[model samples]
Target chain A: GPKVLQIPSHQIIDMGQMVTLNCDPVSNHLYFYWYKQILGQQMEFLVNFYNGKVMEKSKLFKDQFSVERPDGSYFTLKIQPTALEDSAVYFCASSLGDKNTLYFGAGTRLSVL
Target chain B: GQQVKQSSPSLTVQEGGISILNCDYENDMFDYFAWYKKYPDNSPTLLISVRSNVDKREDGRLTVFLNKSGKHFSLHITASQPEDTAVYLCAAGARNNNAPRFGAGTKLSVKP
Candidate 1:
């Protein structure tokens, strides 16, 4: 089974600070996605990226959030000036293409204080 | 509104019994449906999936039945074992877009 590895399984940061969550998707995968899950809640879609561009994003994807996969490297989600409400487990996923099975990472738990 | 929904919050079944988990979606454009199993403190893993082209798909003791007309789908596990206890999450997605919307998940407890 292909694996999407997320770095720093747990991250604690102060509010108003910038934080970057990295994901190493399957080597052959082309589509990338990010999901947010708050405790005791459903997994919420944040954004999806393909061909180095963002394809679709949900309302949960705030203006302070951004995503990029630099030169075929690790895909990253950067939050500039984070807020307390941003505390949640962020899961990264990748798939071969649309209509394909998606591989997900273990999720990076972000705790904002 | 939740595009995908799992009405059941939890279920319990005896070993060797059949476990049926149901899910529903509100989107008509969704062409792909899948079921994911998640253990405690672990990431969700793909168990089985089916596209709208078919009504039913079977893999060993696991079966996925899709009812597109009703906007619903289900995952049925036969000869259920205690090891099968976990949280089941249903998801739906479209063809051109890869971001799948997941349900709230239903927790299953297979008692021996």
Candidate 2:
């Protein structure tokens, strides 16, 4: 079992503000992903990244959202000018390959007012 | 800590029949096990879970069977309904690994 740590288990921000969620994936994992889930809803896939580039992304991955893992450091998801609709739990996951099992963070709950 | 396998990609069963979903693991340290259910366009949600300490667990019409020796587990849904149709995912975790590994997924269709 590899731990995927998500910073600040809970985050509260005002609408139109900016926020950055950080994740420390498994050291040997190469494929990375982000999922969004609202309470009582299903876990929705946002985007997947590999080899320092985005492999695929869903429409839910709005233009305001961006992901990057710089120089082999923490993988990050940043949202600028956040909207109220963006409020949900964001989970970060990583695996050794795209087809491998994903190790997920406990999730960062974003509350935008 | 890594491999969680769901051999079946899809299943079709009659309404009110029993629906079985199976999963396997490659790690011996896997002490935690769980299942997730997902609908189209929705995120997967935790359904039922059990630890290695127990061999079976039941909730309403859902049951989880674990066989440590075989390194396998399964979810059995009785009285299956159309509403039960969704993608099912299996997850396994080891004592030393905090991250639980998940299987690809198995889509289930209950014909009414």
Error of 1 at B1 (Å): 2.2
Docking class of 2: incorrect
Q: What is the lDDT for B54 in model 2?
A: 100
Interface RMSD values, listed in order for every candidate = 1.1, 9.3
List, residue by residue over B9-47, the lDDT tens digit for candidate 2.
Answer: 899999999999999999888888989887865545678
Candidate 1 yields a Cα-based lDDT of 0.95
Listed models, DockQ each: 0.78, 0.06
Question: Clashing residue pairs, candidate 1?
Answer: none
> How far does residue A7 in candidate 2 sit from its true spot (Å)?
0.5
Interface RMSD of 1: 1.1
Model 1 TM-score is 0.98
Alpha-carbon RMSD to native, per candidate: 0.9, 11.1
